[model samples]
Target chain A: MFLQKKFKEYYSRAEIGMPRRFTRREYGFMFFERQMMLRHISFSSSQKLRNFLTEKAPAHVFYSSAYYSKPYEKEMKDKEWLGADLIFDLDADHLALPENCTYERMLGIVKNETKKLLDDFLIRDFGFDDLEVVFSGSRGYHIHIYDREVLELGSRERREIVDYVTGNGVSIELMLGKDNYAVPSVSEPGWYGRIGRAIGSYTDRILSMDDEERKKELKNVKGVGDVRAERIYEGLKRLKKEPRAVNALPKEFIEHLKDRVAIESSRGEADEPVTSDIHRLIRLPTSLHGKTGFLVKPLTLEEFDDFDPLQDAVVFGDEKVSVNVLKPFSIRIKDFSCNAEEGIVEMPEYAAVFACARGFCAEE
Target chain B: MQPTILAKYPFLPEAFDLVKDESMDEILHSPAFNRARELGVARVQRALKNEDSFLFIDERNCFDVVLSFFISKAIVSQMNDSFLLRRHAIFEAKNAYHYLEEESRETADAVARSLGIKRDRNGVSFVTFLKYSPNAYGQWKLANSRLSGGMVEVDDHTFLRLVQEAVRERVEGIKFSVDGLEKTLDLGPIRAELANRKVTHRADRVELESFPPCMKSIMAQIENSINVPHQGRFSLVAFLNGIGMKEEDIMKIMAPIPDFDDRMTRYQVEHITGKEYSTPSCDTMRTYSLCFEPDGLCARIKHPMQYYEYRLHVSSKKV
Candidate 1:
């Protein structure tokens, strides 16, 4: 109940602007006490949206990436899909991080991944310029692309885009020259060039290591034995200098290296199902996340480079509040870091809201 | 464009416009259109026979070629068989590609643009490539193809191939009214040929090991007495009947369902076979979300029967 009041207060003060074609988008909400979502709703103007926000104070807000001819229709076929903005969601939960990874560290890792997706794939390769990035209010980032060419793509075509970024089905044997001996040229386009460059860097990394480490690394590759590793180590310099020397190593070694290079050169790990789903509803930017009380903030590419969610997304002011800490928890927000144990503690309003909402502490 | 070129490529918009206002009665029964009518029947027969022979184009015969193409379309609409429609579309598109290879780049580009393929300063848009890439091989997939500045960079040959794909889809969707055709030409021989093609028996030896993964999964579900969804049950029954399973055998295979009634199951099985319904294509199965656990072979073929046929051929080659 207190969280709902605080959320309502935030909505009252915040100047939340509307998304593009806001009236055409299907909006969905989950109120503070309700578990089921009230979806397929539309707004006519920013004032109407604001009035609803201030009055209802929904705990979670979402809008569809797709535009429809009839947004109010309950049935999918009746909706008559016009087009959709391509969406790529990169969540830290989907990444293969260490078990004890901290939230801050996880965000940092996902930030780099999102950067690679933006610069390497979307910008450099696909040439998509009309894209926006949002801090997902927790755990990750979302990239929304409003490019005209990608608007009417169906699910299979969208999956092909996913396959390209993820480097699915890239075959090393196909990249070989006529003799099947020479490696792909660095000047080649698409995955060929990317994989070729990755191979060069991986060779350099292997050569920079000490003798024992080098042999261990070579043998660590799946199809390479000790003898094959020794042969590869001897031929490493030749392989780096002359691309055709790739065939000097065991065939299995080159095949395995190609698979590794394909992985290393892939754009980034994007959540596949999200991009393929045309009717996906994403978290509305500038809305406060119910669980963490952090704003789902939008950022420019420059602002996103240095943005810290724990500090920047804290919307509440520094009014002091008393909270009963039911469990030990640590949080750092707005220069106030709490390493509270199970006891009563005085904290600022933002910290109190974050704690109570997270179920670590409660208002006294 | 010259009439001679339009005659060669009757699938083009100019050809359609030229023949659009012509009287169907004259085209079907007029002494002036006797040669056109014969050529049109020959075109449909060639497609039904799965032969991709091209019709010769001459400046003198421009009108006949344009009229014949639409007449062939009318015959296709009169028959109204999905399999024959697909075969005819593919045959015509292949023949178009053969002619397109020798045409000037400007002519080919215009045809492609008319079919909704956009080409700006930056090669063809990725949207065009993706929309037409489904039936293409893996190498032609958007992932494998080269893209720059939001466009797919293609050589002239690849561009026409993309145009060929577009033409196939366009022609496959073309339907003409044959409301008054019964009073005109006798289409009995063509109808008999289609019926004969339909009843050509499969090998008595069924290859259970060669079934597509979707059908295999549905079979497993039914054998375990699990309640398969309506789409799954329909696809499974259609596929089994398509692969030459006996009606009684299909009923036996379906008997393990929890709600199976002997008479009802037999009737439904007979209905599928009696209607001669071909198994739904892979795309349709995917739209219904019934394509489950696709194997490597599934990626190469567009239909369930193709999967079975390819597997059967491979196993026979091994023997």
Candidate 2:
């Protein structure tokens, strides 16, 4: 009887204030719609009263006046802990009431105004065909999407969708009407279309092909030599288009192509191998079997000059010999038939021992 | 008149009483008084006759003479107490040693200066103490304060000689001698000598006997093991035949074998074989086999049965 009376009063108010285009049932409580309507009641009401209203006329409650109450204030402290689907706290201060109103009256007015604003915003901007609001037991109301698919989306992607709805910088136009904001179409070429859209199209094309065809095209494509680049291209293409009928290629071949493509692309135009004239001299240990340990004997200046009468040589310590005190006399002994082309140097064991000893002693 | 009578008459009761009271002289008979006066005059006459009469009158006993002698003669013996005797002697000895030490330091410094060797303060003291502090003998002379005759002293030379003997004995306890050995022989030269000696023994059958039987057997095993692979690959039967042992006999000698997996190549087998045998599987097999089981024949052989069993076990366990 009380619910019938309340409905009659709300109905009379709706008839006078709401547009006549809405159906009588739309303005009144349908069986499922009651849950959403009763949720707007002020929290100061007794639990018995709330239960009674909710049991018969279950309405979506929006708790928008948490600023005035200490309990509600404490509950909304950790915005993250609320697990709210959509938090509307950014511009909550604009919903505050005048000082003359009592707490319950102020809350009621704010709740009604906020609910109307939310309904209008959702319908006009986002075109949400179905939405339900619930009191957050704190500052803002939670807007839940009962659709499972929307909930199944990854957290990051869901955040992106939420950002788009909230009119973030890149997606602001999505929330505005055609008169207020215009989104550029992909059909006309712009900076985004040329670079971003073109890459996306190219990726779609590559991913649409079979593995064998893809490999052939990859192999034929010039400058696609490095593996990482090829893998990235393949990934972008796969993301853009559906899989083709071709079987999965062997991992080794795919990896090989990817590596090659990465290397080629990274190298760019400079493809030739580097060349140098400087040669490295590797000093090998003297060994008996190689004839590298017994051929050239280290001799003093006097001995060297006497042996080779054509040139005068002077010994400098143990390792060096100078001819005429200026130009040094150089000799390289070859091992195994004395072949200079082989770069084999033979040194007498006794001369090596003497040289090593003399080198160490001279350093000290 | 008599020496005994004179000694007793000095301490007599009647004389003591007469001295105590002037009226007591009337009690003394005239004869007694005359006798006493004569004795007294005689004593005075004796004193006037001798120039050394005071010395005789003040003569001391042996104990008093000894005490005075010790007090006057000894350097640090001022008190007669036996407890202080050792401490006084020690103090006097320390003082003497310190004086000698300082004097020696000065002398050493002068000598070093003359020789043109730099002498710092510490260096001078080090040399002085090094010389005067008993040398390495660990003995030194100390004064004896208890003696009454003269200043205490010790024979330092005799003490030093005894210390030297003790030290010599200790040194001799662990002495070693190498007779007829050249001190200048280099280890390198010894190695060269050994190499030359080894070459000489190569042809000597008697020298071969110097190697123990176990060493000879190991050498033979190593030689045979290496030679078998070089000769050619032998079948199970052929290998047994070459070794003059049947399969069962060979297995009996080397049984209760552990299984290996197929992944374990012949190189692994050869590795456990200590390079005594080589397998065609891989170059590292001999080395691997040597690491696990160097002594076993199975380490050298790649048993197909064991490999299969190991593989089966591994696959089952994995499953």
Candidate 3:
């Protein structure tokens, strides 16, 4: 009763109207409150949507993928889907970070990767004018592309986009010159461009370094042997000094150089399955996450760098609440860290919300 | 409170001349008002203005006009963020005409039917809008043969103009005859061009020179009674099925096997025929060590199916 009243009161303070869906059947999940099941629901207006949210008080508000012509229709297949947004889910779990890594570290990695995706791939490669980035609230980030040009892309095309973003299926043969002996420049489309740019930068980086550093860097390149490394240094110098450029290297030597570049350059790690899905329900921004008493926040790319989920995403203020804690917990939530023993804890309302939401404590 | 008409909702131009004109007939005829705008709203506006369901005497001209509007207004908002030109592509048309892969097939059909235009399932399709969106947000669009072998991102208005221009270019296709028979095209040049094109087919199996290099090599190996690998056998079966070869003929090709099992071979061939197992992709073939770089015919294409298609396309066989 208290949770419902509190949740409703908090929700009524909305300055802006409820975010409209392409379909009125708003999807949400409140897993810990009950057995979580994803089902379509209709709400006519913002008031009705608010009613559903507060009454159900779902831990998570998920936006459905199906934006139907007849949104009120019950069944998904029966509802004629007009179209949906192209969403890219970037999760912390997808990153190459160490196991048992902290949330902050994982978020940092996600930020770096997502920034690269936005700068290099989305805007530069695909040429999308409008790209939306949002925090997943729990794990990583979500990138939404709203361009009509891609509305009709089927599973095959979506898969190709994933392959491109992840740098998968990039061939070495395609990157190397066949008729003309020049590596495809950075201006080329897709991986050939990426590999070319990587090699150019790598060459510059190695040449700028001392002889020992140069040897170390070349050795680290996956396929470069000592002799090949020496040859590459020689070849790179000739590339810099001579008009013959990189063409002076033998075909076998070029092959090895290309392989080394491919190995060194390949590092696109987006969650593959998410981008390919045409109809995917994503967690709604600004909705409270039941798992951690934190708001599932949405941020622009500019706002993302300064915003920290642990501090900035908390909704509740500093009113204290007493709860019988089940387990000892040490978590940072907006400077009010809950380093409580396995007993009763008289902590702030923010921590209490997290503790109660996580089923870590019972409000007494 | 009255609802506000969202400015630039579809086509960015909020006030078109048709909407501004006080005279009813002038608005109805529309005086070729930015015929490039192809605003689907123009169709509704024209119908409302003309007070008739059909706009032009020739439905292709009308379709071209209406298709522009549907793209400009119905499909995308001029705010530069609506459905990609591929949003709910709904219809696909593929025949001979370059640039157009598909358009709003069902919508066009309904519009055509209403306007007394005959819609052919195949043949005689020109100035098509081919839009294939293959993933969640990745797509290929060819609406109106105006892309000049390249693609461009378009707002509703731009898309409308491009499609209208294409329709105008192929306006001769819009026959004015009573039954469309009198004004129908000769298609003699097109037919001659097709006849002169080199084509490989399952039906034309007797022409050994028309065979793709991979298939030809596989056949040679089969004839020499050399042991073919599992991957080679699979590729052969898939290739045969694709070319519409019969079960007996397919088995005959495989009969030269040193340790041939009749039941096993028959079942595999039957499976390929039934589409129980699809042909492996070029990548999968490479993984199986069955893919070989064959000279000629195979240079540009990746798959055996593509190679066969390429061969048939280049083949100068007559209809």
Candidate 4:
């Protein structure tokens, strides 16, 4: 139920429009996994439990999972040795913990003990909006703030960010010190508007749903808020209907619409009978056989090239046949070119039909 | 023996024959010979004036050939088989003048102190020369263990002045003073007897089987003061100064063979202390010593052979 609520919330907030469909199975799985991952209350679950986070409070999180396993062992030995809470197929060479503790009672004793550092130092210096948190699902949380504006930043810049946040010359243990979580202020340009735009776009999707969908989705999606669902629904609706109006749309949207139309049309025609074109006639090449010529009904290019009408039929008098009163058909008297060059001759079925329906061809 | 002719004039044997008709004494005292001596002296004086531009003085050819024979032999004798000096030439008579001047100053102060002479002026002249000279090729060879020709030259007077200043500073700046101190200190006769008497029964015992009482107390103090354990049971010398007893003395007393010859093992040190002594590995010791020397005193014991080699190697190749 929690997963279903989460999925509905996600659906309401998501910006996909134009009758984009989801299988019931996929929706159910996503909801179930998210709920199970966030079941435990710890600093690492901050991302999972972000809906319950209070405004402006700082929190530290760590991401951890068991890295390896053997058939004999239920869990990895190193994971157990390190007291890891979850196991995953990822490297766990280094263990990290966050400096600040937020929402002490729910997170755990470790977080409660580390809360003062978050409140006194990090919160005091770095404003509440400067802090962002993500759940790592297993042992830790990833904390990020979209506030750096370095252009074309590379891997080195990421390391520089780590160094700046941790403070120069500060050891990992010192950065995660129980007494202090506040890092010194690093003078750097702030984050670009591009990052804010991305966040704004996602937030809009989550908040676009109408009231009925929003309420239903919110109940299912644990973290989805009403505002996000409304935004998402509105965005989706705008995306779906706006291009059909007089206004021009982006090429991508046009393509998306075309694909949607094709899918719908194909579904509508599923029960129709299959038929070949009657007006179109395909020509084929000649075929031959030893001591006799045999005419073959051509099906494809290869058969058409192999069939030789002149060689397959013996030369004889020409005749005319009529298929209907308005249409007449002509044929030449011919003998069978196969079977020891026997003189047995036959005309095509079209000629016979023409003779029955109308008069014969006129002599010329 | 016939009067020895110092100027054989080997390159011009005929010149010597033409000049040899006169008595040896007459030639030796002749104005011509005196003129030659004056020419030699002038040549040396001119070189000394331009010594700053020369790498060496050919004392053998320049001084010995025409200058007074007595001065050349004196300079040559002082230089014996010291290979570094053998490769360089000296201004024998000129250097003798300087050496005598230095000796006179030393004698003057000694006489003044002994006889209580209150002369206002000591009349001692300090001669200074400005010159550039190369170190001998052999000196370079000794330093690098390879033959090389490039040598550093310095103004001898300036070098001596720097040396004097450095010595004065070092002597003045040293914190510990051994002045007026007696050479010997009394130790209990029991310890002396233990050191002198040959104890044959303990020959098979390990060198660090036990520590002296004084060393044991010092080890305990070190252990308590620093959280780290002592490296090993040590001698009284190590306990006092954090260095082992001098190797030469150990060899003289104990006559330890191939195994214990002045180099004590970690196990042996631990055996003596009756305590677990955990010494950092040699590499760790080196790293810690380099990092923490200015901040903290390193408490690692070094092998005497290693210490001696370091000192010898550094001194021989000192920049």
Task: Give me the TM-scores of chain B across the candidates.
Answer: 0.67, 0.13, 0.35, 0.17
iRMS values in order, in angstroms? 8.7, 52.1, 12.7, 28.6
In candidate 2, which residue ranges exceed 4 Å CA deviation? A1-113, A124-130, A137-140, A170-364, B1-319
Cα TM-score per model: 0.84, 0.14, 0.58, 0.15
lDDT of 3 at B96: 8
- In lDDT terms, how accurate is model 1? 0.81
lDDT by residue for model 3 (B70-125), tens:
33332222212111221211111111011222334554333333222223532111
Q: Which ten residues in a row have the lowest lDDT in candidate 4 chain B?
A: B124-133
Q: How accurate is candidate 2 locally (lDDT)?
A: 0.27
What docking grade applies to model 3?
incorrect
Best by lDDT: 1
Clashing pairs for model 1 are none
| CA shift of A279, model 4, Å | 62
Cα deviation at A247, candidate 1, in Å, is: 2.5
**DockQ pick, better of 3 and 4:** 3
Task: Encode model 2's per-residue lDDT on B1-319: one tens digit a residue.
Answer: 2222212222222223323343223312344344333333232223223211111111222222222112211211212222123222222233222322333444423322322323342222111222222211112111000001111112333323222222222222222222221221122332343356445433222222222222233334444543222112212222222222322343332222222112221322222121122122212233223222223433443542233234435555776
Give a tens-digit lDDT track for model 2, residues A1-364: 3223322333233212111111110111223223333222223333433343335432221222111222222222221111112222211244446776543354355455444434433333223434344332222223333232232222222332332222121211121113533222223211112122333444566677887676666656554545634664555544444322111333343333333332222211100111000010111111011111121122232342233211111111133321111222233222111111222233332322222222211111
**Candidate order, DockQ descending:** 1, 3, 4, 2
Candidate 4 per-residue lDDT over residues A83-161, each given as its tens digit: 1111111101122334543322223432222232233222332222333322222222222222222212222222222
Per candidate, native contacts kept equal 0.38, 0.00, 0.00, 0.00
In candidate 1 chain A, where is summed lDDT lowest over 10 consecutive residues? A169-178
Candidate 3 residue A85 C-alpha distance from true site, Å: 0.7
Write the residue-wise lDDT of candidate 3 on A1-364 in tens digits.
4444445556666432344463443465654457766566655666776776766677667766546566555655565556666778888776779888877788888878888877766765566766677777677788877676565554335555566666554555445645665666666545556666776776677789998888888777666778878887887877655423676655655555555565445545566557755556777766766667677777776787787877877777788778888887777777777578887778888878877777787767
Task: After superposing candidate 3 on the true structure, give the runs of residues whose Cα lies further than 4 Å from its correct spot.
Answer: A1-6, A15-21, A24-26, A72-75, A176-178, A186-193, A208-224, A241-244, A247-269, B1-284, B287-319
